[model samples]
Target chain A: QKEVEQDPGPLSVPEGAIVSLNCTYSNSAFQYFMWYRQYSRKGPELLMYTYSSGNKEDGRFTAQVDKSSKYISLFIRDSQPSDSATYLCAMRRSNFGNEKLTFGTGTRLTIIP
Target chain B: EPEVTQTPSHQVTQMGQEVILRCVPISNHLYFYWYRQILGQKVEFLVSFYNNEISEKSEIFDDQFSVERPDGSNFTLKIRSTKLEDSAMYFCASSEVDSLRPGELFFGEGSRLTVL
Candidate 1:
C-alpha cells in the first residue's frame, strides 16, 4: 500500500461553502501531519500543521489528525475564490533525526465565485 | 519576512546534459532540503543538508545527483546527466530547526526543469 493516500479530487464548490480535504496513511509511525496549498506552477505553501492525534486551527483553516485511524483532514470554512488550489497532505515520523516528509497526491479544488 | 529564493525559474535542456539549480534559503535557517515534483505527482524528497553535510537522502537521490552548499547563502543541486524523467519542478526549502519541527520549513517558488 502507498504510505499516504489522498483523493485527487478536482472537487468544485461554490463560494462560502465548507470544504473538507482528507488523507489516510499506512505508516503508524507518522506523528506530525500538515496541509499545504499549491497554486498552478507554484510551490506548496503550508496551510495547517498538527502534532499527534489532535486538532489545530488557524483562521479559516483547521487541521485534524487521528493517529488510531491513520487519517488526517483539513477543513476550510467560508471558502473563497482565493482558496481555489491544490491541497496536499504531508506527514513525518517522530524519529529525532528523520526529516523526510511523505506527501500524498494533492486534491485540486476550485471555488466558484 | 525572509523567504527562500530560487534561480532560473524555468530551464529546458536535452537529455544527458548536466543541469544545475540554485537556491538561497532563509538567512537564519540551518537545515536545507531539496524536493521535486513531477507533473501531476506528489512532491518527493531528494535530500536534506545540515552543517555542510548530507544528513539524509531518499532512494531517488542516486549517484547522478549531488548537492552543495558552496557558500554561506547558496545551496545548489546538480544533475550529472539528466534524463527525460528528470524533468520536474525542483523546490528548495529551509528550516530554523531540524527534526524539532517540520512545519517551520519554508519553500521557494521552485525551479522548473524540462529535459527533452
Candidate 2:
C-alpha cells in the first residue's frame, strides 16, 4: 500500500458550501501534516498545517489530525470559486531540517458559482 | 511574501540527453527540496538538501539524478540521461526552518520538462 492515500476527487460543490478533504496514512511515524492547494500549472501552496493529533484553524480553513486513526482532514468553510484547485496532503516524520515529504495523490476540487 | 523561483519554465529535451533544472530558494531558508509529478500521478519526493549536502532522498532519486547547490543562491537538479518517463513537472521548495511543528514550505512555480 502507498504510505499515504487520498481519494482522487474531482468533487464539485456550489460556492459557499463547506468542503472536507481527507487523507489516510499507513505510517505511524508521520507527525507533521500539511495541506497544500495547487492551481492549474502552478506549484502546491501551503494552506493548513498541523502537528500530531489536533485541530488547527486559519482564516477559513481548518486542519484536523487524528493520529489514532492515521487520518488527517482539511475543512474549508464558505468555499469560493477561487478555491477550485488540487488539494494535496503531505506528511513527514520529523520537523528536522531537510526531511523528505511523502505526498498523497491530490484531490481535485471545484467550487461552482 | 518571499517565494521560491524556478528558471526555464518549460523544457523540451531528447531522450538520453542531460538536463539541469534550476531553482532559487528563499534567501533565508536553510532547507531545500525537489519533487516531481508525472501527469496524473502523486507528487513524489526527489531529494532534500541542507548545509551543502543531501539530507535525504527517495527511491526515485537514483544514481541518474544528482543535486547541487553550485552557488550561494541556486540549487539545481541534474538528470544524467533523460528518459521519456522523466518528463514531469519539477517543483522546488524551501522552508525558513525545519519542518518541525508544522512549518510551511514555499514552492516555486515549477519547471515543466518534456522528454522525447
Candidate 3:
C-alpha cells in the first residue's frame, strides 16, 4: 500500500459550496501535515500546514489532522471557481533537513460558476 | 516577494542525452530540493541538498542522477541519460529551515522536460 492514500477526485461543485478533501496514511511516524494547491502547468503551492494532530484555520480554509486515525482533511468554505486545482496532501516524519516528503496522488477539484 | 526561479520554462530532449535542470533557490534559504511529477502522477521527491551536499535522495534518484551547487546561488539536477519516463514537470523548492515550525517551501514555476 502507498504510504499516503487520497481519493483522486474530479469533484465538481457549485460556487459557494463547501468542499472537503481528505487523505489517509498508514505511517504513524508522519507528524507534519501539509496541503498544497497546484494549478495547471504550475508547481504545487503551500496552502495549509499543521503539526501533529489538531485543527488549524486560515480564513476560508481549515486543515484538520487526526493523528489517532492517521487521517487529515482540508475544508474550503465559500468555494469559488478560482479554487479549481489539484489538492495534494503531504507529510513528513522529521524536522531534519534531509527528510523526504511522502505525497498523495492528489484530488482534482473544480468549483463551477 | 522573493521566490524560487527555474530556467528554461520547457525543455525537449532526445533519449539517451544528458539534461541539466537548473534552479535558483530563494536567497537566505538553506535547504534545497528537487521533485518531479509525471503527467498524471503524484509529485515524487528526487533529492534534497544541504550544506553543499546531498542530504537525502529517493529510490527514484538512481546512479544516473546527480545534483550540484556549482555556485552560491544555483542548485542543479542533472540526468546522465534521459529516458522516455524522464518526461515530466520538474520543480525546485527551498525553505528557510527544515520541515519544522511550519517550514514552508517556496516552489519555482517548474521546468517541463519532454524526453522523446
Candidate with the greatest lDDT versus the true structure: 2
Whole-model lDDT values for every prediction: 0.91, 0.91, 0.91
Q: Considering only N, C-alpha and C atoms within 3 Å, which residue pairs clash in candidate 1?
A: none
Clashes of 1: 0
lDDT of 2 at A86: 98
Summing lDDT over every window of 10 consecutive residues in candidate 1 chain B, give the lowest-scoring window.
B96-105
Residue B80, model 1: lDDT of 98
TM values, all candidates = 0.96, 0.96, 0.96
Residue lDDT tens for model 3, A1-113: 88999999889999999999999999998999999999987888999989858899999999999999999999999999999999999998966665777889999999999
Using DockQ as the measure, which candidate wins? Answer: 2
**What clash pairs does model 3 have?**
none
**Model 3 reaches what TM-score against the true structure?**
0.96
What RMSD does each model have against the real structure? 1.4, 1.3, 1.3
lDDT score, candidate 1, position B70: 98
Task: Give the C-alpha miss distance for residue B48 in model 2, angstroms.
Answer: 0.6
**Runs of candidate 2 exceeding 4 Å displacement:** B98-103
Using DockQ as the measure, name the better of candidate 2 and candidate 3: 2
lDDT of 2 by residue, A37-101 (tens): 99999999888778858889999999999999999999999999999999999998987766777
